[model samples]
Target: MSTATARSNLGNTIAAHAILITWTVIALFPVFVILINSLKTRKAIFREPLALPNAESFSLVGYQTVAKQGDFFLYFQNSMIVTVVSLTFILLFGAMAAFALSEYRFRGNSLMGLYLALGIMIPIRIGTVAILEMMVATGLVNTLTALILVYTAQGLPLAVFILSEFMRQVSEDLKNAGRIDGLSEYAIFFRLVLPLVRPAMATVAVFNMIPIWNDLWFPLILAPGEETKTLTLGSQVFIGQFVTDWNAVLSALSLAILPALVLYLIFSRQLIRGITSGAVK
Candidate 1:
């Protein structure tokens, strides 16, 4: 650590932070616009779309409509159930499979890893018709179970890919020590490996959370029932073919953005570390 070397490191750190800040602003600019306009009068929204709401312009019509028109609480509950349950399964099963792939030396292991990783390259929506038929055959259509199953399938590929990489990076000597200490395989996985990959788990959760929360495709196709409708689909009541309700739309979007934003904030540190884990070291 010479003076010049320390100064260079400090400069690089500042540059990285500046780039991240700029990207964050660019990414969130649309959300900011929608939030501001959601609080404005319909007329004010169009007249001053980019401007902040003033006394005369401020209105709660959008939120009022959201409250009155649909079972928003139900929709929110449905979304929460679907997202949380799906993430739970994705993390649990994905981690297990990843642990197996990374920790074991079995025949066709490389092929199995490649097979699972293929999901990352291929779009799941390509099999939408097949999935729908399977769901229908099992009578899971129009149920939250249908949404959970579909989302779990959609998220697992990336989870396995990411988690396996992190799992492979875990210390083999530590795992061997756990084995010699009379720890069962499951105990070692649950107590040792999973904790060490917490950052990777957080990364996978955050990556999968937004898409599941904001998704309209599967919900519309698989579970369009009033009781099963997610927040994204339920917001469609405010949307029309010819005449759209801008206020209600913006208000719904603003509401929808909150959970994802909060989750990201909670996992922001772990997510960054997971993404950058091996790059520096």
Candidate 2:
């Protein structure tokens, strides 16, 4: 409130902004470099790597080459289906479980929550041998269903944990009021609690979508067929096949980066808000 105090606070704020900006550039500089160079001729790229693209330097050759050489659109679709379907089930089932855990004070509740959360610390990749055998035994190999089931299982642990934490903070009075109104437990969840948990749901969706979208391991193990390969796995194979083609390589990397960047930009606020609100911890 005093003049000197206010000035000192202002100086601290300026220093914090400067530090944040510095780190932000450090994080984004490599991505910026790749995108700019991907649009330039190879000669121009090497000669003026730091320069903004101009008409003389601008070329769509990389994109053209990537599009021609790879079925990028189909790969994009496969990734979308797996990511979306897995996320939907994770959020729905995770929320229902979270609501029950938070609302009920039953015996062994804490242990149950911890048991489900075990999958969070333990990477699902450790069970790859069993998962693959199961898929093969069930004749689901090279099928999107294989990838979807695996990702859904992998994502559920963290989703339930985060949603349960937030669910605990919901006012008890609301649940009591719903019950007083003769609302069944199912109606309370569907009509009242679910609507109130949107912020937490957005938080979970953003967190889960990234790993599922970017995963290569499960897709490679479960569904490497041309029709079923997700974007990340397909990109790896495509780049391997066209390793000598710099333009296609850069373009393929860019194509992979775009969807993730878009999702981050859209959901970043809610994701950060969730962490600060202690939804996970």
Candidate 3:
């Protein structure tokens, strides 16, 4: 290649990297501020908001206050329980429903698919009143089970929609071979189909699980009790009560953020892999 061409390519690469770095900083700056402020004393936080924690300014008082005032562990447990159970139900039922719609020709199959797909377009918040009323009537209000059920219902449509498309791409020959080997339809789905669609499921799970974990509305409305509070709701309530205390407020925000951040970092690779693998196939 000519030197001019090489220089032009190098300039473009540098410009691209500069833009990416700028965007990354914009995205992370808020979290960075919150985390750093959480570690500083109130005076230092107010005086030097952008400064990092130094020997003189460093303090754990906010975290100490948060730990003393809240059932952090219990709240964490509730969040985890609701997210995990809801994801499990969404994957299992969504996959089964998608597989049925994609692999078999039955009466009303198109209608069923349309009905399920409707949920993707409609926001679940529109049905909050009805969901709360039903939960109250069923005695599920204030229970983790209620959150799980609500999240599962909310997540199912998109899960089914995504999984169904992937299911349709599964080789018909492979399914027919399973049948020829005397495998039951259920066996074929559980053994062969499930494995084949694992990447799509992972993608769906990562996408849906974040919203479930960070949700505050359902938990606040339906399950605001001390035992049932999720980390998000708990942190909100805590921060509200201590809003005047900047350190405590920042600490609470940091606490709520770090788990989700860590989880995203952990599963981000799987999410990327799923997308790339599905694209390649």
What are the models' TM-scores?
Answer: 0.83, 0.91, 0.93
Whole-model Cα lDDT of every candidate shown, in order = 0.88, 0.90, 0.92
Report the lDDT tens digits of candidate 2 across residue range 29-80: 9999889888888778789888878999898898999888789999999999
State the local distance difference test value for candidate 1.
0.88
For lDDT, the strongest prediction is 3
lDDT of 1 by residue, 1-281 (tens): 69999999999999999999999999989989989999999999998799999999999998888788767789989999999999999999999999999999999999999999898878889999999999999999999999899889889989998899889999999999999999999999999999999888888987788899989899989999888999888877445421378888888877777766887788788767766765223
Error of 3 at 213 (Å): 1.0
Superior by TM-score: candidate 2 or candidate 3: 3
Query: What is the C-alpha RMSD, rounded to one decimal, of candidate 1?
Result: 4.6
- lDDT of model 3 at position 18: 100
The root-mean-square deviation over C-alpha atoms between each candidate and the true structure, in angstroms, is 4.6, 2.6, 2.2
Judge candidate 2 against the unseen true structure and give its global Cα lDDT, from 0 to 1: 0.90
Candidate order (lDDT): 3, 2, 1
Candidate 1, residue 81: lDDT: 96
